[model samples]
Target: MTDTTARTIPIEAFGPGAQSVDVPVLDSHLHHVEAGEGDPIVFLHGSPTSSYLYRHLFGLLAGRGRLIAPDLIGFGDSGRPEIAYDLADHERYLDAWFEALDLRDVTLVLQDYGAAFGVSWASRHADRVKAVLLAEPVIRDIESSALPEAFVGAQRVIRTPGDGEKFVVEDNLFLTAVLPGAFLTPLAEADLAVYQAPFPTPESRTHLIRFPRNLPIDGDPASSVEYLARNEAWLASSTDVPKTLLTYEPGFLVTPTIVEWIRENVANLEVHAGGAGVHFVQEEQPQGIADAVVALLARAEAR
Candidate 1:
């Protein structure tokens, strides 16, 4: 029987005092911040952002469970090896990180490329995943016509040989332009500085440059497209998994059409209106996200 007497955990302030612990994974180390104890609730950030993206969530999800957020390899404080920052490389490092931590029965909170990684891992290791919350995830193949003309043009420039390096590396386009534009509220100078700290040198921006180019769009990037298809299939069949999808107004990836498709395809799914935002819903609706996550946890535990 389910524990009906379980009490709700109160949220608190996760202020500037929060610190990250580095764990060695593979040849490098991954920096992560964790709070509370018991079952693990892991948060994964995407391109141009680090675990710092979920700083607000740690406070909101306090005492509910063990909350952990890790910076992906080549981003934030994680070690940047000389290998190409491709999807497979990131996946390999993340797999090692999870093994090193010996994490089990995890609840994943994912965004952007993080969603892709998390969902892929969950599909492969279904027993380890307890629940999943996705916001602005890269879960489907994208059509070129579906994107804004200007955004498509920019992607083309970013995918080109010499121009891609200039646009992403030299100009720091993802950090300078894309990240700021995705947020509804203007990010303060200090907050922007945190996002910029990892990519000080042009060469350090390799992962950022690779992200947009690797987007699974229009049947290209066959590898990502294949994995997304597998994840979609898993989502359809995994009716026992409690999944919550937070959708925002004028969202970049998970548009209304995509949301409707998710409604039809994904099983045991709950959709929550995440209020106004562009791509970065966490910045705009942290409370809403927390509420959804808590509700999903309850549902998962009820089973």
Candidate 2:
């Protein structure tokens, strides 16, 4: 029924990641892996990538605590239903996951596209969040995005032209554009298969197709306008939560101007070495990120 022609990608793996990997019988409900034993920390992956994205973090934190990372629906080994994907859809999944696992005292490690999903969840369940680590995270409204012009122009091309829907998600250019920018090093050719494995059909790209244009810039793109507003309000008022921006070396997210916007606009915000590290700082600087998270938890524990 599905095309098997996609090249098999050897998704990166780490034996040293988390101490134990227990996949509950949840099935395609959400492709997940759990390691270690302690307070639960769920890592949410960005679009076009799966739990495989956190391969390094799993190893780093598995020993000190519990780690759970899931592939969002239509992204990884998870089921790709024929449905529209949006911020609310992702929030629903996050709620179900936390409730299903009975998660509490959580620390969220979010990056890239995952920022939308994780930030939405944090805002909704503010009391449960213990701390936060955001790397090259997306927090801008559509108009304010500091992402390269090339990237934004492509987004406009694919979403406004009506025909943008066809290629935005399905075009190999999406993968080409995102890969080298986010990770510290050029991803191996084999790994590209893992990232590209999920969307094998035009229909399956429903979420990928819709994700970009949904940006809430200048409130033009109706759907995302409100979401960006809600998330910003939450971030601005989340004084009780311990929030840290683990930047990368020269960061891979929007641009420096945008980063300055976050620093000046966002309240209760702190910074780490995120802007100075590689794109996959979690992988390249897993220990430092993990240490920062643990320290946040420790502060929470102390409180």
Across 171-290, the per-residue lDDT of candidate 2 in tens digits comes to 755665755566656677666666777666665565686666665555557666566567888788887787777766666554566677778767667776643465556656777877
Which candidate should be chosen as best, given TM-score against the real structure?
1
lDDT of prediction 2: 0.66
Error at 303, model 2, angstroms: 2.3
> Can you give the TM-score per candidate against the true fold?
0.92, 0.82
- In order, candidate lDDTs are 0.82, 0.66
Per-residue error for 202 in candidate 1, Å, reads 1.0
CA RMSD of all predictions: 6.5, 4.5
